[model samples]
Target: MPRTTLAPTLALMLALASPAAATQEYILPTLFDVAGVAADDVLNIRADPNPTAPVIGTLAPDATRIEVVEERRGWVRVNTGEGSGWVNSRFLTYRTDVWNEGALPQGWQCFGTEPFWAFIPQGDSVVLGGPDTPNDMRKVQSVLSTGVFRDPTRAVVAEGMTLVSTPQLCSDGMSDRLFGLRAELVIQGNQPRMLSGCCSIQP
Candidate 1:
């Protein structure tokens, strides 16, 4: 067979073997926030095409300002100011809408394990609670599930007096598991509340 024909034949074979062959590639926007660590330590970003491989230094975190990079196999390759490195994709947040300056929604809070949450009025509120530990400054660390919201008609918000947005570091944090969530509740309201967190809800 001609060399050119051979290439096409091989391509077809590979496609047939791949389960995602029929799926269209959709590039989604992502957001990367500084996870509790000082911006200086967040430096030394590296890449990990292979999760099992040691992280390879890509750049200094301070030098790079671009948010959201392409991800592969549950990992995201971030470009530090100096180079590129791979971080677990679960640590980053992906959003379809980018927040515009001075255009944020009212009463909505952006909450996450990455030390940031924005509050917008009339927006979905997320409440995340997990195991309480004495050493944890935030006193809570966990994610929310998509099914958490029960009633769309009622405004969702976070409740409890101690619910302030702060960074909490955990070695086992993963984004896909609802590392952070938004809920609707009154900050000053007095009511018993059960919030979802890192672990599954018991029946």
Candidate 2:
């Protein structure tokens, strides 16, 4: 390359490497891991994005695969027991392995009350069990989602069931744990029951 062209090319490369360009790739509805806390210490979740905010909950020092819903002023919003809280972003490390191309994350679980139903994804089929329905496995058909890479809306279609999860605050109604995604499951049968619940990427 000529000297005149080299300067502009080098400048363009540096510009793309800047922090501003990197921020575009960092989006919400992503996973995070607890970091910078001692083994005996716990990370506090506050009610607001300030140091003096009321403490809402705490996370174990070794907690991993935490879903962060939003970020504000160096604080990241995470779901705690039945609610959302903010934690200092400095203590959480982002995870690169995220749900992409409409694929569900590993160990994804969905459950609901008012009949007590649960959907568990196994190797190639989805195990659906409830108090009323028979415990049966359905073959996986396809997973679809929005075009945006970071969007947290996805649908899992099977032989007789379609499970759709969207980015929203959800509660199990019995537990104090808040959830980042709201799940709706439709079972195609004689009755065609529709169930609503919450989902979590964490265990």
Candidate 3:
């Protein structure tokens, strides 16, 4: 205290206040999407709300099913089937309308080429085959024809994984068909790691 300078004292105060200032809270949007990553780098899925936390798992580029749990200080808590962890908020995008309507469950990442025709189940993996007929049941048969059907013998779907399924249509063949075939695909390894969007029938 004998030689305390104003500059040094101010610096000390700033440092102590930095932690509190860095902590911020944001309301999470209903449906969020993660994109813009290469298909190689391990998307670090962390346990704590901070990036410095221990890595619990990694998300492949083609992994589309991630459920977000909570948001704290620019960090989002999400579930990746294997466990729960945090991801930086910068990589996320939110859709309130879709989420509020129960179209997308909480903690799950909703994605599709079309807005609302199809979505991947949360915490599951999907492989994207080529584009298919929009909302057409015949496309499901086509995907199966490509030999991407779910293999009961394979382990969990991983990066570079592809699957084909014709989900039952939820609506009558009338205004806005609600059902269509979808290919949930995963792309991992190498640069640009990412979980691609679901390629489905057009809406």
- Each candidate structure's TM-score, on Cα atoms with residue i matched to residue i, is 0.26, 0.76, 0.34
Candidate 2 per-residue C-alpha lDDT over 166-195 given as tens digits, one digit per residue, 9 for 90 to 100: 888788899656777899999998889889
- The C-alpha lDDT values of all candidates are 0.36, 0.85, 0.43
lDDT by residue for model 1 (44-152), tens: 3444566566655533343322344346687665544344456665444443333222222222233323323223223223343323422111222222323211211
Comparing 1 and 2 on TM-score, the stronger one: 2
Local lDDT at 169 for model 3? 23
Could you report the Cα RMSD, in angstroms, for every candidate shown? Answer: 16.2, 4.3, 19.4
What residue runs in model 1 are displaced by over 4 Å at the alpha carbon? 1-27, 34-44, 51-66, 95-203
lDDT comparison, 1 vs 3, better candidate: 3
Candidate 3 lDDT trough over 10 residues, lowest sum: 146-155
- Ranked candidates (lDDT, high to low): 2, 3, 1
